[model samples]
Target: MSLEVKNLSLKIGAKKLLSDINFKLETNEVVAILGPNGAGKSTLFKVLSGEHRHYEGRVILEGKDLKSWKASDVAKLLGVLPQSSALAFPFSVSEVINLGRLPHSTGRVLDHQIITEAMSKADVSHLAGALYPSLSGGEKQRVQLARVLTQIWQKSDLGERYLLLDEPTSALDLPHQHQTLSLARDLAKEGAGVLAILHDLNLAAQYADRIILLSEGLCVAQGDVKTVLTPQQIESLYGIKVTVMSHPEHHYPLVIAS
Candidate 1:
């Protein structure tokens, strides 16, 4: 199963936010979207998550039109963690995570078990009773991740689940940044499709099976790490000199600014 976007474009009264975007996000792989600022990365993510509708082209989810699926059904098979959350409510961490289970009719007992597992995965078990607003930015980010994890926790008969994360590591510390993407990689190994919008090229290189590069509302290139992240391409995209070499301890490319 796959999520495919073809000839996708969007506009806000002809401003042309995105133009002719095409890509396939498939099961059991982690795909990363890398780009400079104002490259329409977030707008493209909004489209995939069903937050934007006035656009051209198609988003096929598991061989069916994404718009055709019921909101609840979509919730069960796709989980989204956006760039930020503005929630000021004093909900406890566990309560916030429990909201992810709202789309299902699963019994309370099973739901509790799922919530616990999600919290554990996110490393927020000790903060279960803490108020969400009382936590630091990174802590809250992890809680939100746990919530989305609860939403798509199981591989239901509905189909393989897909995850969309918009700058999921923005508020995280150094270790947790790697931790978050590592968890994403692990999920792909367990049979889910994962996509992330990232500014850190090295992080994408380390974790993504493939990379999609965007610039000014269009795709610049898409391919495996070494094929797409040449030094020439990086300098052209960001207007800076750089070096691209293989990581000494790993297989993916390593990028250094010059």
Candidate 2:
């Protein structure tokens, strides 16, 4: 499956947040959305996930309009991991992960299988019976990722699963951050389109096949890391002087600053 956004714009009250946004996500591609704080990155994620409806342009999935797809249908096709997900009541990690099966048919066997697979992929299988509220920040993030993985992991139609992650590693430690991104890259390698909104420039450069730089409600740059992470562009977008260097192993652009 693919995602295409054309001339997209959004506003709230009297402020325009995103303007004329245009991008396409191809199958097996990992695209990172990078921007400064309050640059409408979250809003764009909402639009992509179909959580926000009112917009000026189109969000097309596989050539069909996003709005035309039913909520259940969309849930099966795409899984969204937001910056923060909270549960009012204390639910067991297993219970939380099982919630991902809501979009599927009611069957205990299938639910158990999906939850088990998701937990294994997220490396949270040992914490399955623990209370969600009692877990550490990184643990909770991993549990949430398991939930999303369960939601989209259908063996028969696996190629259509699209993972939308917004700052998935914000609350995680260094190890967990790499773990989460590595899982995302693996998913993309398996023919899933993974779109992530990330703040860590180095992580984005290392994992993302392409980067989309948004600044002041516009997509200022979109391409490989070297072309998109230039010193001038970094300074212009975030008011920071960044030095770009090539990674010794991967040869990808690496960002550093004084």
Candidate 3:
């Protein structure tokens, strides 16, 4: 029903990178991880994605230990889009996106259909024939998103799908930034749990169902947008004074820095 991290802590060499962190990402909601630099957001993400697996504590995926799940089986349920992708291959955009279908035995016809749909959803359909390395940063970001989207395009027998997006909108334009998160929201509505690492408080407020704030490898706060984005929390974490106000046309909090 959810991805749960219990008492999660990670240490590299003698220095601790994460400490006793706990959070759950439930189905059908978008969650944003907000924090100052070096707060272990990316480290938490890497742990969840199985990149740094030597940490203490447990990551429970759907009532089972995450480490016990086979890599291929896990791929069917979780799609991860990191802060950046480094691929210098000459493959075309569509080819890069098609690589997402590798984990599935879905037939060629069905895989092509899914790839096309993902490209459309990620707004990279027009770049289907373009060389992957030739695209701009934002364009490459969308293309990488399309690739991950195709990976978990359908909810397998695994029950619920999950998206672990590390700064998904980092390279996007303002409109495309909204567009990207909107697409994540749509996916969540379809029963996927979305967890993204975001730096923009307003963007997280506008789209996330909840926000988890971390500072210095620990969670500072975690709750609904309005409750967690208070002026006090902003100042304490980022060392900046800000006023939190309700958006004039929307229901979420808007943090205005002074």
Cα lDDT tens digits, model 2, 3-72, are 8999999998899999999999987889999999988899999999887899999998877889988787
Better of 2 and 3 by TM-score: 3
**Which 10-residue span in candidate 2 carries the lowest summed lDDT?**
152-161
Model 1 misplacement above 4 A: none
lDDT of each: 0.94, 0.90, 0.95
What is the Å distance of residue 132 in model 3 from its true position? 0.6
Once all C-alphas are superposed, what RMSD does model 3 give against the true structure? 0.7
Residue 83 alpha-carbon offset, candidate 1, angstroms: 0.6
lDDT of 1 by residue, 1-258 (tens): 899999999999859989999999999999999999999999999999999988999999998899999888899999999998888999999999999999999999999999998898899999999999999999999999999999999997888899999999999999989989999999999999999999999999999999999999999999988899999989999999998888888878999998
**Model 3, span 1-258: residue lDDT tens:** 899999999999999999999999999999999999999999999999999999999999999999999999999999999999999989999999999999999899999999999999889999999999999999999999999999999999976899999999889999899989999999999999999999999999999999999988999899999889999999999999998888888878989998
Instruction: Give candidate 2's TM-score.
Output: 0.96
Candidate 1 vs. true structure, TM-score: 0.98
Instruction: TM-score each candidate.
Output: 0.98, 0.96, 0.99
Model 3: residues with Cα > 4 Å off, grouped in runs: none
**Model 3 clashing residue pairs (backbone):** none
